[model samples]
Target: MAVEEILERLTRGVRDMDEELAAEAAQDALANQMPALTAINDGLVRGMNEAGRLYETQEYFVPELLLCSDAMYAGLGILSPHIQRAEEESRAKVVIGVMQGDTHDIGKNLVKLMLEVDGFEVFDLGRDVTPADFVAKVKETGAELLGMSTLMSTTMDAMGVAIRMLQQEGLREQTTVMIGGGPISQAFADLIGADGYAENATGAVREARRLLASRGAAVR
Candidate 1:
């Protein structure tokens, strides 16, 4: 199939929720004769954007969104290494994770994946992580940005704990904190003294980039 046709089919697969075809189309794009990066990146971002809209409107739940994300990943896996090498000098480094007691990681994982696609280096801490661990990772990695997730109201306090710990240890001045999750909000993020608050994955990337840029980070 022609590259245009393959990209068109990929778009249709995502719009129609044909998971199998979406995956296949991604692979075809990978193996196609011409430059695959532009087409695959466009299709991947478009599909993920559609999924984000579906999620925001409550038209699709987590499982379906996850599947669409999987399709995006199918394409992104091909692009990310190239994207990273394209910027081997460095784009940016980020530390991301879910807070302690928050075992859920869907939102956090999505943010990590999307950020990586955008060419930012990410260090994921998995789930059930403490504030000290987050701080330690930041200190060790020298990440430019720190992103945190808390899915439950009960664990929301952990975001503040992490932020305060940063301030206490003088890391706050060096690393910017970007916090989010179900219970997280702009007001609360301010209350916790986070550098930024993202309502969702895209916003997280945008905010993190903005904060890092303002701080004159390598990539903003």
Candidate 2:
């Protein structure tokens, strides 16, 4: 099949939530020497955008969205190895985690995957992470960005505590902070002094780039 046909199939596979087809199409794209980045962006990401639209229209619910995301990631796993990152040796490092007392991670995982596919090296700290742990990781890894997630309104305060810890430890200037999850909002992010807020994985990638650029740092 032609590259266009393969990419189209990949896109359809994702929209249909056919993980096997998406992965197969990705392999075909690789075998045909299609640019992995092209396959990911023009194919999987495009399909995900369509899924997002469907979700907004209420044509697709959480289960369907999750399935679509699974299909997208199936293709991503196949194409990721072939994608050549421009600054592989010094890719921007990002530290991510779910805040203390909150264990939800589906959204956090998706954000990490999207960030990685966009060429950012992510250090995922998993769920229920403490403020000290977040601060220590930034200081230890010298990461340029810190991303926090929480599904509960109660645990939201953990993000603020983490940021304050960073400030007290003198690490705030060296790292940018972004937040997301079920109970988070732009106003809350602003109140917590976050650098940015994203509603979903796609927005997270864009926001991460904008935040990095605003800090005079390179996104890749």
Q: Residue 76 deviation, candidate 1, in Å? A: 3.6
| Candidate 1 per-residue C-alpha lDDT over 159-210 given as tens digits, one digit per residue, 9 for 90 to 100 | 8899889888888888988889998899998898988998888778778878
The segments of candidate 1 whose C-alpha lies over 4 angstroms from its true place after superposition are 11-17, 34-36, 77-84, 87-89
lDDT for each residue of candidate 2 in 17-128, tens digit (9 for 90 to 100): 9999999999999989898888988899777777767866789877887899899989988998887875144689999999999999988987886787667889999999
Best by TM-score: 2
Question: How high is the lDDT of residue 105 in model 2?
Answer: 94
lDDT of 2: 0.89
Per-candidate Cα lDDT values, in order, are 0.79, 0.89
Q: State candidate 1's TM-score.
A: 0.83
Query: TM-scores, in order shown?
Result: 0.83, 0.85
Candidate 2 TM-score, true structure as reference: 0.85
